[model samples]
Target chain A: MKALKALSTSVGSKYLVALTGLSLVGFLTAHLAGNLLILLGPEKFNGYGHALISNPLVIPAELGLIGLLLLHIFKALRHVLLGRTARPQAYTRKVWAGAPSRKSWGSTTMLVSGIILLVFLVSHIATLKFGADYPSAEPGVRDLYRLVVEVFHSPGIVAFYVVAMVVIGLHLRHGISSAFQSLGLMTPGWTASILAIGLWLSVILAGGFALIPVWVYLFL
Target chain B: MKVHLKVWRQTGPDATGRLVDYTAENIAPDMSFLEMLDSVNETLIARGEDPIAFDSDCREGICGTCGVMVDGRPHGPDSCTTVCQLHMRRYNDGDTIVIEPWQALAFPLIKDLVVDRGAFDTIIQAGGYTSVNTGGAPDANAILIPKTVADEAMDAAVCIGCGACVAACKNASAALFTSAKITQLSLLPQGQAEASTRVVEMVDAMDAAGFGGCSNEGECEAVCPKGISLKHIATMNREYRKAMFANR
Candidate 1:
């Protein structure tokens, strides 16, 4: 872990950023795949929820996820603050000054997107993760399926979720490939393809999350 | 050809600066960007005004000295060429050009278009060296370096330390500059002995100098006078990680 201790430096912190970001991407993928169970109706969704909480690994896995999220946030905040301190005097008139295809906008706005995501994450946890519980739809379980359906039913909450997803998407646009480059995973021949995939993944991942709320609100 | 210039002028590091307009008349198309500035400076001097103070050495572009933001692009609108080598032909006649010093908190303005890049020297002093003692030179072929490695090392070595990369970076990050030195030395067998300590020390120095971390934005590579690639930064990232992780 001495090596990891050294990673506490700015560049090393970047690797931590990439690692945590990738881990969160994994978390998102699994979360979405599991969320898909809601489409099978409340019984299956609630059953899935009960099964998840019943597993011995569930509590530890949740704790690990929280750790990853906290680490990601801490690193991001440190870098953002360092970035601001680096250029105390701002440019008077500015242009992005990079290739249009490989936009720097995403890179520059990461701090903003991160703040938005942090707010959204807090609201998400407060509203759904620890909000009021209904009587069991399944024996010896909270009616989490009713909660999901009820949560998405509100147009305002659905709208908030969609907007937050877009923010998350924007963060991922730069975060994905940047992480790879920071970790030295990029090669000249593969950079373009990797970036292209990163872009598509950003859109798909965010779009997938946004669709769930809308899908449940409308048809389910 | 003629051009209108809006140049940033400041009396000193703490003095207020502003973009003031000037005109260059009858400039030759073939003249380098710095040459046109020379004409403008000459006119200013003739009028008993202080000429713009900018840094330049080895007008051929290798010294890594002369640099300014012309129309928001570092070293003027030219790619892979320093301001001293950037031809006036890249601009149309009657074009308006805006020039500013490398604006970073870490680089305080000396006067006019020159800023003190002492932070770079500080970062260099932190580790940008191999500690071989003076002795008889080793045989040229004594240490075998693969052709690919020699080429790659040369690629990183091509960095002129112009500060253009930092100036052009949105966050004013010095990642490109720091990594260039890291990649250049860390690739060699002579440098390997101290790679671990060097990377950690250099990066700490860089951050302490108040330079931002690399976002891998590629802006620095695009405007680099020496065509230094982002790959060097990537390599540094890898090397830095290995140095840190392996230390444990």
Candidate 2:
């Protein structure tokens, strides 16, 4: 109860949001690495996928990831609601307090991008993880590579995936540095580097993920 | 010089307000923003109309008594300057300047361009002081404070309690203001005794005042008249986290 009370404050809620958000970013990094294994051909990709799902710890990790995502959403939604009430009246002619202020399209539209990503996440899991399960030639290991290839074969899905990745990039553009600030890890000496990393990391991760579907749609 | 003014006019807190336009004429470029408003108010009074209401004191910018959303930016377009100190030269003739009160739930609009910053006072009263008592002023050498620590403390202490940070924030968060207070006290030897209780109580008071959470956008830091760095906010967060665990 004490911890919960401590975490419910404006400062504490932000701390939790930052912690969960950065954890999700960590999960994304691992996920992207795993997804990129598709480039190694079916044997390598399927073997990797099979190895991952077959591990006993996989289910617990997946559940933990789900818990983290839910908590992130809960805290983020609470923030948006609180923001609305904080300034009951809107400014008639608000302007961005330009540079040195990190206000951006990404920062402003984080809620929108996040909501979009949530919808994309559900559709993504349904199509790939819970979609058609074709048997592998080696047996036991579901042909996840085939499922991925088949999914990417659709132009509509490939286009959608690319668009979703862009939204993810938009979320991360502000999220990375923001998380550090929320966690109190940001300092004058490290602020500039953190900002740069937030921008480049978002681009690298989103662009890297986006390339996969495009590469599959074209070459595979 | 002349400029077009679209100033917010509200009779009371519950009254619906709107921007009423008036032309400010015969304005000198050297005049401060508040002085220009004085010229406009003079004209309105001469015309037997209610003059635009705003707040100002110590027009030199130290009192932190004057501020308004001038053309959508708090304290006008200048950086590290308050509204009372913002010069009219920043504007061109015929420029349409829109002024509005600080719009935050914690800062209720009391008139045309003045909001009650009582929430800040409430936060301060919660824990912005040290309980240490001394009967007389001690010699400067009595406290062997490091120059860097003293400088850092002074930097945080420069915050004039202006609510511009809240006005500039998208979330209308009081983090910058509260953080400045927390950091200034936490860094000093006198502040060490109550450090844990101070951060916890002040932060709780800030949240209870209906201020939103910080998004770390740095808009507050950018708009701050005293150039209060966002580092103080980081320092505050560290203090808060430490207080939570230590006090527990």
Candidate 3:
């Protein structure tokens, strides 16, 4: 109870958000790695998917990810409320303090991008995880590779994934470095590198995931 | 030079405020921003109208007393300078400046361009000071603080508590101000005694004061009159984490 109370304070809650956010980043990296196996053909992809699904630890890991996602959303929503109440009156004409200031379109639009990603997350799980489960030639191993190719074959679904990946990119563009600052890991010497990491990580993950679908639609 | 102005006008705390237009003519380029306002107020007083109200004590930048949203940027566009130190030379002759008070629920409006910054005092009261008793003044070099450490502490110490950080923050958060106070004390030997309690209590006080959470966007550091770095914020976070674990 004491820990809960401490972590719930405005500053403390930020620690929670940063930790959970970065943990989710870790999850994305692994997910993206697994996703890239699609380029190696159906046999390799299906076997990898089967191994992951067969692992008893996968269920608990999925549960943990869900918990982290929900907590991140909860604390973020609370911040939105606090932000509203902090300034009952609004500025008449607010302008961005340019240069040396880190404020950006990505920083300001965090909440919007976050919400869009949340909606995409739901539809993504529905389409990929719970869609048709065809059995592979190897008994008991689901043909997950076929499902991915079929889904991406549709131009509409491919376009949706591309748009969703762009939103993810924008979200992480601000989120990665913001997480370090919140966790107190940032320093003047490392600030530039950390900022670069945020930008490049977002691009890599977004572009990498977006590539798989476009590749499958065009070549596979 | 002459300039047009749209300044926020409010009679009292509860009164609805609006941007009332005024013009200052024949102003010298070297006149400070406040001096231009002073000239405008002179015309209003001569016309038997209520002159605009603002706060200023020690027209020098060190006092942290004078500040206003000049053209939406805190303390005007100059970096590491206060509103009082900002000069009219930075503006074009016919430029229009819109001025507003530091708007935050924690800092209530007292007049047109002044808000009560007593919440900052409350945060200081919480734990911004060192409680250790030093027997009179010690020798100048007794503490033996490293030069780099002293310089960093002084950097954090330069925060004028002008509330520009809060005004510039999208969430109106006091994290930068609170962190600066925490960082200055935590870096010194005398400050070690209450370090843990200081961080925990001050952060709690900051939250109780109804300030918002930090978004780590660096706007606060940018608009700070003293250019207090956001590194102090990171230091504060580290201190808070250590304190929470240590106390538990």
TM-scores, all models, native as reference: 0.93, 0.98, 0.98
CA shift at A162, candidate 3, in angstroms? Answer: 1.1
Candidate 2 chain A lDDT trough over 10 residues, lowest sum: A1-10
Candidate 1 is graded, for docking, as medium
Question: Considering DockQ, which of the candidate structures 1 and 3 is the better prediction for this target?
Answer: 3
> lDDT at B213 for candidate 3?
93
Backbone clash count for every predicted candidate, in the order shown: 1, 0, 0
TM-score for chain A, candidates 1 onward in order: 0.93, 0.98, 0.97
Q: Could you tell me the lDDT of residue B22 within candidate 2? A: 90
Rank order (by DockQ, best first): 2, 3, 1
How do the residues B153-239 of candidate 2 rate in per-residue lDDT, one tens digit apiece? 899989998899999998999999999988898888989888888988998999899999998889999999999989888988898
The CA lDDT of each predicted structure is 0.85, 0.92, 0.91
lDDT per residue as tens, model 1, B80-194: 8888998888889999888889988788889999989999999999999999888998899999999998888899888888899899876688988999899989888988988
Note the residue pairs that clash in candidate 1. A3-B244
Which residue runs does candidate 1 get wrong by more than 4 Å?
A: A1-5, A187-190
DockQ of each: 0.57, 0.78, 0.73
Worst 10 residues of 3 chain B by lDDT: B239-248
Mind giving the per-residue lDDT tens digits that candidate 2 earns over A67-147? 999999999989989988999999998899886788888899999999999999999999988999999999798999898
Q: Report the lDDT of model 1 for residue A217.
A: 95
Candidate 3 residue runs with Cα over 4 Å from true position:
none
Please estimate how well model 2 matches the true structure, expressed as its whole-model Cα lDDT: 0.92
